[model samples]
Each structure stands twice: as C-alpha cells, then as structure tokens.
Target chain A: MFEIFSYSFMPRAFLVGNLVAVALGMVLGVYPVYLAIIVSVLAAIGVEKLRVDYKDYAELSLAVILSSALGLMTVLVSLSRSNSSIFSYLFGSISLVTPEDLWVIFPISIFIVGGVLVFYYGFFYLSFNEEEAHMAGIPVKLLNNFFMVMVAITISFSMRIVGGLLVASMLILLVATALRIAKSFRDTIIYSIILGIFSVNSGLFISFYVDLASGGTIILSNIIIFILVVLYQFLRDKIRTKRFHYLTSFRR
Target chain B: MNPAIEICNLSFGYQKNLLLQEVNLTINKGDFVAFIGPNGSGKSTLLKLILNTLKPKKGEIKLLGVPNFRFTDWTKVRYISQKVREFNDSFPATVKELIASNMYHQMGFLKLVTPKLSKRIDQSLEMVGLSKCRNEQIGNLSGGQQQRVFIARTLVKEPEIILLDEPLVGIDQKTQHEIQQILIKLNQKLGTTIVMISHNLESIKGQSNKIFLFKDMDVFNYTAKEFTVHLSKKGEWVVNNSYV
Candidate 1:
C-alpha cells in the first residue's frame, strides 16, 4: 500500500487530498460546471459590446483573441514536450483541478454572482434598449465597462473547469430551456440557475457511477433537459389548440 | 417664460459630411412640436442632440434652462426612439415588469419596490389602456400594444417633456388614431411638452401646435397653420396632404 501510494508529499497529500475530494464531492463538484457558465456569459457580453462599438470590426475581436490563445497554447505545448493530449485542456478533466485552482475559483464565483446581482437592473434595461437607457440617465458606459470586466474575470478564472469548447453551451443551453416556460425575466433567470444546479449535480452523479467524462456529461445533461423543455412546450401548445378548436366547434 | 428647449446655432455632422448647420430653434413649455423632413434630413439627429446622445460640432443646446451637457434630471424628460421595438421579442417580461424597469434608476439600485411605486406602475398602465394586459407577456402583445406599453413605460417616469421618434411607424390606422389621441390628451390635459419627428404631416396638421420643417440642412420653424400654407404654396402639400 505504501509503495503504491508513494510520492514526495505523501502525508500532506493524503490529508489535503481527502479534504479536497470530500469538498469536491459535496459542494465544489458543481463549481467547475458553474465556471463554464460564467465563461460563456463573459464571451457573449464581449461579443455584444464589440458588435455595438465596432460594427464593421465586430468579428475582429473574437478572431484576434482566438488566434492569440491558439498561438500561445501551441508555444506552451511545444516547449513542454509532454505526452499528455491537448483534449484535456480543451474539453476539461475533473481530475485536473488542483488546490490552487479551488482558491481562484471560489473568489471568482462570489464576484461573478455578486456583480451580476448588483448590476441586474442596469443590464436588463440596456439589453432591452440602449438609447432609452441613456435617456433615462443610467451611466451606460460605466455599467457596460463594469459588466465587461466582470465577464472577463469570470472567463479567465472558469476556463479550467469546463474547458473553452463546452463553456458556451453550459451558459446558454440552460437559459434557453428556462425561457420556454418562464413568464417573466426574473423567473427566467431564477429557473436557469435552478436548472444549472440540477444539471451539474446530476451530471456529476452520472459521471461517477458510469465512469464518463464529467464536463461532457454535464453538457449532455443540459442538452437533454433543453430538448425535454422544447418538447413539453410543443405538446402543450398542441393540446391547447385542440381544446380551443373543440370548444369553438361545439359552440358553433 | 424661458423655452423648454433652446438650440443656438447648432451644427452637427457625421465624419466629413455635415447634416445640419446653423440650426437655431426654441420649443416652449406645453407646446406640441412636430419635426418633418425627408429621410436622412437629420430630424432624428437633432432630437438625439437635444437628448444629449450626440454632441454638436459647434453651438449649444439647453433643456429646461440647463445646458444639455450639464442636465442631469432625466426623470423630467422621457425619450422614445424609432427602434424601440427592436428589443428582443423573446425577452421574458410582462408589460408591468417592462414599465417597472424604467423606475429602477429612480428608485436606486437594489432598493425594494414600494407600494407607491407599484401604484404608479398601475396608473401609467391604466393611462395607456394596458392595465388589463399588465400581466400578459410582452411578446404576446400586438405591435400596436407593444408601442403603447413603451409609451406607458415612459409615462411611469412622470416626465414633463416627451421626445418621440416616429412612434406610429408600423401600426394600423385605428391604433395610430388611438396613439394620436393619447398624445393629444397628454399634451392638453397634463400640460406635457411633446417633441415628435414624423413623416405623417397630415395626421399632425391640426394636432401639433408648431412644425419644424428641415430643408437644405436648415430648419424652418413655423406654426402648424403657417406651415400648412407654406406647404400648399410649394406643392409639397399634395404629397403629404393626400389624406386631407
């Protein structure tokens, strides 16, 4: 047993490892999933701001960022000369989260959630009508910059959890599912967060039992939920239409 | 009495092309002023300047006796843009929620909504005849009803002056007439000042008290009665006054 578990920091590692695993299993299991959401939201806002400010050069920002990230990644991969595949970095691996990563993720999660709550009204107003928001005397530029910075910080901190490839789907898929049945903006946001929590927990459970990739499982679960929501909406509409036709025919 | 809006020798341009030059105008309190011009004639640009969305190349604009740049009392004035309906149709909000959002700035960030504010929302919705549909999703409403909801949103701010940019663009005739009556009532009964940019001069003939006709990068201000005579003389009346 000692030979199998042999490592330089064995005693400290065992204690920390048990604590970390327990925390990850209990609460932090969903942290990485939420990180994916934060990253995607940041990207969406960045793209929207770019489109608004530089209409002609709207796509240029994403192009530049993607190229720079890719170039740096290539350089790092070449220099490291590691046998490990890049797929883990791109799609994320649950086992890759270190103690240092948790320290970064914890504060960032608080900041992202707190910042969104504080600026919720301003974001809602601006997203609906920018010109009217300006006329209403909301500090449009300041609010916009603050939101962008929050998004950037969130993305930077969260990329390790869900990976760059699957982040957008985690953020948008649950929100889209929530929108189908939500009657109000507040309800939509609440439902999305609820759905997100459900997806992360369920995905983690499935991943552990079935021995599948955690990030991919989470995304697949969200997609499945979204499809179910869509089908429910379709069936409800169909039933309502049928009932309406039946009543009208009987009255006639 | 001082003018509600004062523009002094204002000049605005985009890049190298000048849109308006040496445009001087004054709009008084409780006055309904209609701005009429062809497309690309800077009608919306001038309104944007008054609203301080765009800066003038030279000269100054004063709103309610305060310089546009220095003006901060936004609750006193409301603006409705041409692209008001361009907001995402699928945005999950009811008519009341949409109107209540406009009050958030006034109520301060993160402050709980009070009963007084709730009453105000109900009153504004009632004023726009959308009280019954206050709970309905905004996306489910018709185009005309959506426009009215926006108008109610503006009204909830209790603005003394309302700036409207083509509020009647895509609505049907009956809804258009209803909106015209609503504006007329707001102006006459509540003493609200209205500055509107419109192409439908015929609908505004007897409704608006003043008209600002943009021609050749200059604005010619006239009483509605005076502009009617001027248009008839220039044969421009034939194009716009076909309904009349």
Candidate 2:
C-alpha cells in the first residue's frame, strides 16, 4: 500500500481526495436539502438556455441550448476514464493523499461543523417553519443564503470524488435512506451524518483493497443500506397489519 | 397606534394572473379581524404577501411599524397558519422537539434547550391543555391536537400579533370552539392582535370585532354590526351549521 505513493502525482491525488471528501461532508453537514434542490433546479434551467458557442458561461451558465454541450462533455469525460478508476476523473489518480488534502479537509470540516452549531439558533428558526422562523425575528434570507453557500462549497469540492453524476447521490441518498427508517427530520439528519462517516471510511478502504472506485462504492453502500431499511419496514408493517386483522376478527 | 398589520395599494399576481388588485387594509392592535371571502379571493395570498412569503406587484405591506418582513422583534408576533400537510411528523422528535423550535430565545446560541426548554414547552402546551402530551411524538396527536401544538409553538414566542389562516378549517365544531376560546383568551388576556383569514364568518363572528370582506379582488371593511348586512347583501354567503 506504501508503494501506492511512490509516484509524484499520487500525493496530489490524495490531496484532492481529502479536500473533496471534507468539502462534500461539510456542505452536506450544514446545508438544507430543500433549498439546495430549488437552486440546483434553477441552475439546470440556466444551463438549458445558453448557446453552444457561449464562451463565458460554459460551467455555470447552463441554458437549455448549452445543456446538450454539457451532456456531451459529461459523457465524453466518463467514457475516456478507466472503468476501474474510483474517481470519475479521466486523468486517473494524480498525487496520492498529500498533506495538502489533510490540511484542506480538517480545517474546512471543523469550520463547517462549528459554523452549523454557531448558527444553530438561527437555523432552528428557519428549519421548522419559515413563517414561525420569520415571526421569531430570525433573519431568514441571510441564514438561507448562508446555508446555500455551505452546500455550494461542498459540491464544488466533492465534484472531483463523486463526479457530477453521483455527488447528489451521496448527499441526498444517504439522507433519504435514513429518512425511511427514522421518524423525524432531525433524526434523518443525524442518521445520514453517521451513515456518511461510516460509508466514506469503509468505501475508501474497499477502494484501496479491491480496486473498486471509491466514490461509486460509497454510493453503492448507501443504496444497499437503503434497500435493507426498506426490507425491514415492509416486514414490520406486514406483521403489524396481520396482527391487527387477527385481533379484530377474534373480537368479532 | 400602529396597526398590527397595514397594507397599502397592495397588488399581487402570479405570472399573467392577477390574484389581488389594489388591495388596501389596516388591522389595528388588539383587533380580532377576520378576512372572509370566497376561495381564491387572495386571502391566503394576502397573508403570505404580508408575511413576505409572496411579494406583491404594486404595494407595500407593513407589519408592526415597519414594512413587510422588516420587523426586528418577532417576540411581538405569532402565526397560527391553517394546518398544512408539510409538517412531516414522521421525523423523530417528541412534542418537546417540535416545541423546541419556539425556544430560540432561551438558548440563543446553540438552539438546544434541556430543562429550560422543557419548562417553556410545558407552559405553552399547558396553555392549549396538552401539557401531559409534552413528551409525546407530534405524529401521535390528532389533527386538532397538532393544530394546538402549532398554536402552542407560536404562543410560546409571545408575539404581540398573531396571523392565523383558517385556524378552524377542517376541524369539528368542538375543536373550533376550543381554538376560538384560546384565541379570544390570548387577545383579551395578553392584548395580542390577531388577523385570521377564513371562509366561515360565523365561526369568527363572536371572536371578531371587525370583518374585512374580500371580494372581487378588493377588500372592504365592515364593523361588527355591518357584518350581517354585508353578508346578506353579497347573497353569496352560506351559513354552515357548525358555527351555529
């Protein structure tokens, strides 16, 4: 495994890896999924209207006209990359996890985690119901924008690892999966964060040993977990309903 | 005295459709005003526009002394909205967690309140007579109980103004009477101003001193005595026996 770092680019790859991981984690950690969905939908619409030759807005300015170009770019990039490569990057692993990755991930994660708690009071107002939040005299817009920026930072950083295709999967899928088993929004968030940490660490190790794509493996693990949760729920509901029917018939 | 809510030349529309037109209204402090009209008379829209959830095309809304959503102190206001389906009660939290949202002031930094939060929570729930269900998960409560829980959430904030949108809608007469008593008690005891948007004039008649008849995209005010005259003249009013 030490030989994995013999190459100069490996360190840079690691640096980028750590940076992306932490960035994604920090964003998913703080941002509200509802607002992020609205923004992402709007961004897609913006991408839809731009002309193909529009030079300045390729990455961010997404109009419908430019969407084709974006889609083509996505496919071309994916096809060129090796099937076994964990990250969707076509260039393959560059420098392995360097000190730079650790540096970026640690401070950024700390900042994101700390910031969420720091602004917890403001967010509590905004989270439950906006009307009550505003009525409570919380600055809803500022807090909303602040949360969005956190998500943007996360998406920008993690795009390298999960690639554009799957970053959303990581953020939304884990929360969604957790939501299935949990009873409340707060519980879902907590469960997703716990699942996120476990999935990330485990997936990374699996990628190292089995040569599986780390990002893909990470999302796959979440999918597997979600499936198991659904199965459990189905069985429990079935048993509960059967018992209820039996009890009613016996009483009759 | 500044009205609890004031809208001037307020007009709002969504894309090519006009919802409210040149709407003007004033709600004074301690006033229990009911906004009544047909469905889609822009009643909810007006409430939302005032809340700044929806912006208007050609008017200004003021809450307290400042224009819409500009109030610095929310301790002066509370909103008991029509029970919408959005509050996903499936999330893991007891009534304590749901009410915890209201105690933002007590634990101002982390938004986490333990003994202090529970004390406030218990008090608010007690106001609605659900103090025993303080630890119960919100989903386990009935619709009326949930509505009361939300009202408790708002009341805990101690807002001077309360904006309720059809608080009595979809509930039994008993629940409606119970909620009405609560609203009346808050207004009379706490001197809180309330603006309720509703279709049932009779449900609000005893509670409301003034009724703003929203019709034909315009809002017209009627004093308590004028209410029967205005409803009779409109010929569109139907009295539901639930309020009777």
Candidate 3:
C-alpha cells in the first residue's frame, strides 16, 4: 500500500505534474463555480414556482427543470470552440485534485458543516413542514435560499472529485444508507459523514490498485454498503420475528 | 382585553375571480371559533389571510391588536394548515425531536436542547397522550397518532391562539373526539383561543362559541345559539320538502 510513495523520484514528479495539469485543465478557474451557483439557484426557484400551480406533480416539475437545464448546457457546449477533455468533468479522477482545489474545498466544507450545525433544528422543522416552520418564526425563505446556494456550491465544487454525473449519488447514497440504521437525526448525520469518508478513501485506494475510474468506484462502494446494510436489516427483522428459524426448519 | 383577531373590509382574489370580499370579522380573546362552509367557499383562504400567509387585496387584518403584516410575535399565534396531511411519513424523526422543533423560535439559533426544553417537550407530548411514544419514530405512528404529534408540536409553543385547518378530516371518530376534547381543554382551561376551519360542523356544533359560515364571498357570523337555530331551520326545510 505504501510502496508507491517510496519507490522512485520519477513517479513522484510524474504524479505532481499530472495533478497540476489535470487541475488546470479540468476546473481551470472559479467561473464554473459561480455559474453553477447561479444556474442551480434559478432552477430551484423555477421548480418552486411551478410547484405552486402543480402541487401534486412535484416530480413533473423537477423533470421539466432538469430537462431545461440539460438543454441549456447542450447549447452552451455546442457553441464552445473546443469539446475535448470535457469527459474528465463527466467522470472525475482522484489524481486530478490540486492544492488550489483543496484550498477552496476546505473553507467551503467548514462553512457547510457549520451552517448545518447552527440551523439543525430549523432545518428539521422546515423539512417536516414549511408552513409550520414559517409559523415557528424560522425565516423559511431566507434559510431556504441560503440552503439552495450552499447546495449549488457544494455540487459544483464536488464535480472535481465525483464528477457532475455522480455527485448526486455522493450526496444522497451515503445518507440513504445511514438512515436505514440511524435512529436519530444526529446519528444519521454522524453515520453519513463516516460512511462518506470511508467510501472515498477506500475507493481511491482500490482504484489506484486496480486502475478504475475513481468517481465510479466511490459510487459503487456506496451502493455496495447500502445493499449490505439493507440485507443486514432484512435478516435482523426476520430473525426478530422468528421467521428465519421457521424457514430453516421447514427447509430441513 | 383586545380581540385575538380583527379583520376589516378584507378582500382576497385573483385578477378575475374573487374568493373573499369585504370580509369583516372579529375573534375575541379566548374565543373558540369555527369557520364552516362548503368547498370553494374560501374558509381556508380566510384562515390564511388571518395568519398573514396570504395578503388581503383590499383591507386589513390585525392579530392580538397589532397589524397582521407587522406582527412578529409568532409564538403567540400558530396556524395548522390542511397540508399537514401531506406530511412525509418516511422522514427520519422521533416524536421528541418533532415537538422540540417548536422551541426553535424562543431558544434562538445554534442552541442546544436544554433540560427545561426537554421537559417542555415531554409535557406537550403528555398533553397529547403520547408521552410513551416520545422516542418512537414519527412515521411509525398511525395517522391519528401523527395528527396528535402535529398538535403536540403546536401545543409545545403554548400559543395565545391556535388555528387549525380541518384537524379532524382523516381521523377516526374516537381520535376526532379526543382532539376536540383537547381543543376544549385548551380553550376553557388554558384560555388559548382557537380558530379552526372545519368541514365537520356538527363535531364543533356545541364546542365552538362562534361559527362563521363562509358563502358568496362573505362571512356570516353567528353565536352558538343562533347557529343552532339557523341549522335547525335549514334542517327543517330539508325535512319538510324532501321528495324521498
């Protein structure tokens, strides 16, 4: 596991050069970050407006907004002069991360975590019932807009690590798996963070050894963990109900 | 001494279709009032207007003597919308956490749940007769139990007035009566004024002190005795003229 770092100076230089080249080539500047924030915020607002009229058709609203966003992206990409290396953003690589990306991600990670900590209960109430949250004086509009901005920024920045295509799974799958076992909100947060850290590190390790796409490997790891957790829960419930024993006896 | 809610010449409507117009109504402190009307009669809209969730196109609504738009003391007033039926049952939350969320306003931001706050949550759950289910997942509860959880959430704040939009719509008769008893207890014992928009007017027939019938873009107010007489007259007419 540790032999790669100890072997040769050539390997170290090649690694550093690749990191710099990929970072500059893939993410370039902060323009995409700003663009992501603006576009996602607009999409969120549009979806909300549509939801008011078609309250029962929430998925329809999401689909409409998503297709519109995809269409806009296609038009912009088509207008661009060059189309090479765009696949890197569509499927990310761990080695592509630069010191600059770390510098941006570090502060943002802190801010997002701190925001969640400070507004934990407020968010809990809002998720439970927006109208009731407003009645409880939670400043629903301000917090909602703020949360949307944070989410946009997170998705944009994370595209460097997990790619835009798989970033949603990174955000959702860990939490979905954690929810299966977590009894409380705090526990769910803790379990999700732990699972996220475990998946990313192990995924990078395995990808390095096996020569696989880092982003896809990470997402695959998350899916595997989710399946394992579901299986464990199914077995636990079966055993608790004495059905597993009965089934075994019948088979015998 | 001031009325719990005061609406004067209030009107709400779209550009072409007016839902409510020139709606003048007053609900006194500690009054148990019910808004009863058929579908599309704007009962829910009236409640929304009072709660400042919607703006009146014409006149004014005052809550606890202050103008509705400027009213910031939200802990004093709680409005439970009909949309409570749309609650996400799969949400990962315990009954305690649900009730504790109501303390967010008073406790301010970035605050931890204190021992006192926990006790208040327990008391609220107890009032709703769900103290034993404090640790249970909210989604695992029955529909009536979940409704009680929403009520416990409202009661945790100890509001001066409670507004509910059809609290008993999907509940069983037993649970409905239990909820009614809770409302009556709150009004009579704690003096918490209640304004509930209910389709089941008979359930609130004897309980509410004032019943407002929403019809034809207007609100017709009636005392309990007067409403009973009016309801009897309508009932007699239907009975006397029935072809069946």
Which candidate has the top score in DockQ?
1
lDDT against the true structure, per candidate, is 0.72, 0.65, 0.74
lDDT of 1 by residue, B1-244 (tens): 6589999999999888899999999999999999987888899999889988899999999999999999988888888889888766777887877887788765655633567888998998888788899788898899999999999999988889999999999999999989888899889988899999887877877789998888778898778765553355545554324311
Q: Native contacts recovered, in order, as a fraction for each?
A: 0.52, 0.46, 0.60
lDDT of 3 by residue, B1-244 (tens): 6698999998899566899988899999999998877788898888888878788889999999999999988878987778775866677788888888888865655745778889988888888888899998888898788888888888888899999989898889898888898889889988999999886756666799998877788888888876653245435311112210
Model 3, runs deviating above 4 Å = A1-87, A237-252, B7-25, B37-42, B53-61, B67-70, B109-112, B199-206, B211-244
Q: List the residue pairs that clash in candidate 3.
A: none
lDDT (Cα) of model 1: 0.72
TM-scores for candidates 1 onward, in order:
0.78, 0.66, 0.76
Q: What DockQ does candidate 1 have relative to the true complex?
A: 0.46
Which scores better on lDDT, 1 or 2?
1
- Chain A TM-score by candidate, in order: 0.74, 0.63, 0.78
Question: lDDT tens digits, residues A53-144, model 2?
Answer: 45354433333423443453445335443333323332223133346555666777787777787677566556556655665666766665
- Residue A22's lDDT in candidate 3: 32
Ranking by lDDT: 3, 1, 2
**Model 2: residues >4 Å from true position, as ranges?**
A1-95, A121-141, A152-165, A205-211, B1-31, B35-74, B79-99, B102-107, B114-118, B132-142, B209-244
Candidate 2 CAPRI assessment class: acceptable
- What is candidate 2's TM-score for chain B alone? 0.87
